[model samples]
Target chain A: MKLLLIITGACLILSFIGDRRKTALGLKKGAMMFLKILPTILTVIIVVSILLYLVPEQKIAGWFGEESGFDGYMAAALVGSISLIQGFIAFPMAGVLVQSGVSYPVIAIFITTLLMVGIMTMPVEARYFGWRMALIRNSLAFVFALVVGVFMGFLWNLF
Target chain B: MRFIKKHGVNIGIIVAFSLFAGYSVYTDYLPGLEILKGNFRTFITELISMLPLMFILIGLFDVWLPKEKVQKHIGAGSGIKGSLLVALLAFMQAGPLYAAFPVAYTLWKKGCSRFNIFIYLGAFSTLKIPMLMFEIGFLGVKFSLLRIVLTMPAVIAIAFIMDRYYAKKSFEIKSLQ
Candidate 1:
């Protein structure tokens, strides 16, 4: 967060030096963009919150734990796809799962899909990139996330 | 009226959720309300933390970086260099996936190649420096490294496929524009 502030501060300073009018225009454009997307953002947040409320985290961990097998991978992917936790929170939660005997492959799939696919952000993505691009990118990411999970598992077992 | 027409669905969804929350509270379903409030707070904080900076940077990019300059680096014939540059920029970023959209839109308008733009978004979604560090700390070096190694190729391949598919159908590009 501090990093963002620093960067914004620097940009504002630089903008003043370079062109004050442009700087003002930049701020206006930024605010406008924010307003334009506010609705979609709010909707996504509500949906995510509802999902979080409904899904039991403990049940999820159990389904993805050791001996869960292929079902575990699917479960992890599904849960990861739906949830919108930040990476900071996600990695630690995943770490706990790892220590608690959730297989690496499942964890890998969970993390990969969580970061890459973003079911929750599809509306925002579609708004910008069009539904075709957004859908294609996400579908491909989902398939590749599975491949990465399998490969990570293979590599882990080998060594 | 036009704004209402355009945002009617979103506004409706918001209203529905608000009513649901109100009902939940009236029924004394405190847990659901608590969860909703907590999630809302986190969502707002995330937005407050990142959106301003992202938009400001995008605004600055729009103001300062001319189309010609953007095109020279990442447009039609930019090839490998363009991909590399975008990937680097994306890797350096620290924010949620939603924050990347406006920047991507700006890049697209600035004439960045669709392929490199995919690479940029791909890298932004995963492989960010802070995210990687967190992964390494929790998941260990081997797991983190393996995911990174595999992800890069996947990102590139997806970019290639999407670029080709979009090229074949200019309608997609036109729609986005």
Candidate 2:
């Protein structure tokens, strides 16, 4: 964080030397953009963190672990789809899920889909990629997620 | 009247679905209602904390970068080079798609190909820097690299398939009308 501040400060100094208007413009624009998204991103992170804090790993594992069946996979996928958490958060969640006896496949699928597919961000996706493309990509990704999940589960069993 | 007539069925479906969802949630059948209720305050507070930085970054992108430049570099007719460049840019880019949307919308309007847009999004979502770092840190660099390499082709393939097979269609099934 200190490094980031130093870099940003250097950039600002350079920009100031080069052309004040352009530098000012960039700074102003960056500020506005950051302001708009900060709330939502923070909301997502905090909510996900609190969720991580609250949800017992053992219970999550029980839903998706080795003794579980397709129902576990479904539960995992459903959880992945609904939560808009980042990989930073989700991967730790995956580790917890694994410790709880959740199958590797289920955790893998949950993590993959949680990162790749955005149930919450669908509207943003639709705006950029068009609705059809977003839907198809997400659905296909979901399917591949399942395949990956199963493969990983089987591999984990081998070891 | 004409607009409503055109979208009336879709509207009806959404309303009906929302009503059902609300009713179920209210009745406690949603199962995870506690999470929402439990996390509400903390979530909002965190969101507030992060707001200033997010907006600053967004505003900088908007003010510093010219839409024309982005479009020219990433636009159609640039082919594989453009696609690769878009991928790289998207990969290096930080933050969520929400911040990226203004630039992307400008590019699309200025005639960036559907394929490039798809590739940009595919790469952006999958190949984020923070994620790569985390994977490498925890999973061993080789395993992480392999996964990244494996996933790149998949992302590109998904984009290619969509471009070839599904680009022309609307999201909704026409039959619903």
CAPRI-wise, candidate 2 is: incorrect
Interface RMSD of each: 8.6, 10.2
Cα-based lDDT for every prediction: 0.74, 0.59
lDDT of 2 by residue, B17-103 (tens): 456547757788543454444444444453344333333333444455554454456555348887877776677665555555555
Off by over 4 Å in 1: A1-62, B1-77, B171-177
Candidate 2: list runs displaced more than 4 Å: A1-59, A67-69, A128-130, A154-159, B1-77, B97-100, B138-150, B166-177
Cα deviation of A120, candidate 1, in Å: 1.7
> Quick one: RMSD of model 2?
10.7
lDDT of 1 by residue, B1-177 (tens): 866788888899899988988888889788767866775566656555665566677666666754345334544435787778777667766577878777677667667787878888888876876356457655778888888887888888888888888887863232234
